[model samples]
Target: MTLTSIPIALTIAGSDSGGGAGIQADLRTFAFHRVHGASAITCVTAQNTLGVSRVDALPSAAVAAQIQAVVQDIGVQAAKTGMLLNQEIIATVSEQVAACKIVNLVVDPVMVSRTGAQLIDDSAIAVLRSHLIPQAAILTPNRYEAQLLSGLEILTLEDMQAASEKIFELGAKSVLVKGGGMSGELRGVDVWFDGNACETLTTQVVNTPHTHGTGCTLSAAIAANLALGKDLRSAVHLAKSYVTTALKYSLAIGKGQGPVGHFFPLLLSDS
Candidate 1:
């Protein structure tokens, strides 16, 4: 019998004990796309649907070791970073990414929440902008994050386009300004900008409160598609479609908010 080799994707993120976001969601997204998933957890969070209670970041050396272990042996076709908790970790991860030469990188700048709240400190954000983001093949930032990065207000599609361009100037090959944090008709309308072209991507809004891991899932889906040999634009579109379908069947578990159903096809079959 011959064994077939599968495309592999790596998720360098934090761990969510609630099983809604971070490494958990990324791994699930990778599996759904039939890509072998590797992970290097950056931090451990004690949280559930309601909120995050505690977060303990791992040592920089430990995170580097994990990356080395995976890249040296198992290998990865694409990689992503979620929450690099602090400056030290972010800088370390950035260095490791450069050292490992992981080119197909998707960076979900998890610096702000969908509600416009900042997640990391100024120093960490600075280091992430200076180091890691420039190496990204695709930089995915939510509305608030886009605003912070571009120093502009994102209230319309045009604003999103402009923001994408500004972020693209930061050295990322491409930029995606996510609209999950937008309001009215602008919501769910993402803007994509490469060096040459800028476009808006609209998908059917899956009205659900259980959107805990949508950001992580979308980025992971992008990485999975890249691992499967899709171009950047096609990868983003397919990933958006996958997230939309998953959102349609989003799980309604836990108290505050659950998660998007990464395995929505199984839910359909079970129903």
Candidate 2:
């Protein structure tokens, strides 16, 4: 197959030593979808299923160099950003992405952890809003992140709709406000908006504590689908399905919140 015929997706994010999230999860998701995955790691985390012990961020120039290297040679059909850490890295990544002119950009604004704790400060959020979000073809932010970006508290589906609109107003071509962390019926329901249409994407709630890396996995799957030539709406639908199915096969490893099974299909076939 020629180079153009092969799907390629890039992830600009952090590295999780635990192998459950960040670049690890993103690459795994890309591979499962048969897309060639490349990465520019912004930070290295000493983390596990239990919690993060430490994070060491790379210099802004280093991060930009990685992106430049990948885009100059291998090329990226679609790309996603996760765990950008701080203002300098986010700004640098945003600048590099624009310089590369990557159209299918999925911005997973990873500001909050799965445990509902804030992972980034207000300054980083501001930098993301000003630099990165406007360039996104799709912005995937979880409930707390949506709340932070939109300045609207999300408690109901109506609130999610409001948050989606609010985030869309920030200039993303589209926005997906994830409600997986919400309470009651709102759980597992994601809100999508493109300034013209508003849609709700949902899946059956897989009740398990082993949901580490879900947000990363979902956005990466969406980027992979985009690399495969799917439209934004269809990509979100397929990515949602993939994440839900993976959650059903979530691993219970390391005594805490394990990762969604990215290779669940292969495991099922082997079984």
Candidates in order: C-alpha RMSD to true structure: 0.9, 1.3
| Best-matching candidate per lDDT | 1
lDDT of 1 by residue, 19-110 (tens): 99999999999999999999999999999999999999999999999999999997889999999999999999999999999979999999
Q: How close is candidate 2 to the true structure, as a TM-score?
A: 0.97
Q: Alpha carbon lDDT of residue 176, candidate 1?
A: 94
- Clashing pairs counted in every model: 0, 0
lDDT of 2 by residue, 1-271 (tens): 5666688899999999999999999999999999999999999999999888999999999999999999999889999999999999999998999999887999999998645799888899889999999999999999988888889988999999999998898999999999888889888999999999999887888999889999999999999999999999999999999999999999999978899999998889999
The whole-model lDDT of each prediction reads 0.95, 0.93
TM-score of each: 0.98, 0.97
Against the hidden true structure, what lDDT does model 2 obtain?
0.93
Looking at model 2, report the run of 10 residues with the lowest lDDT sum: 1-10
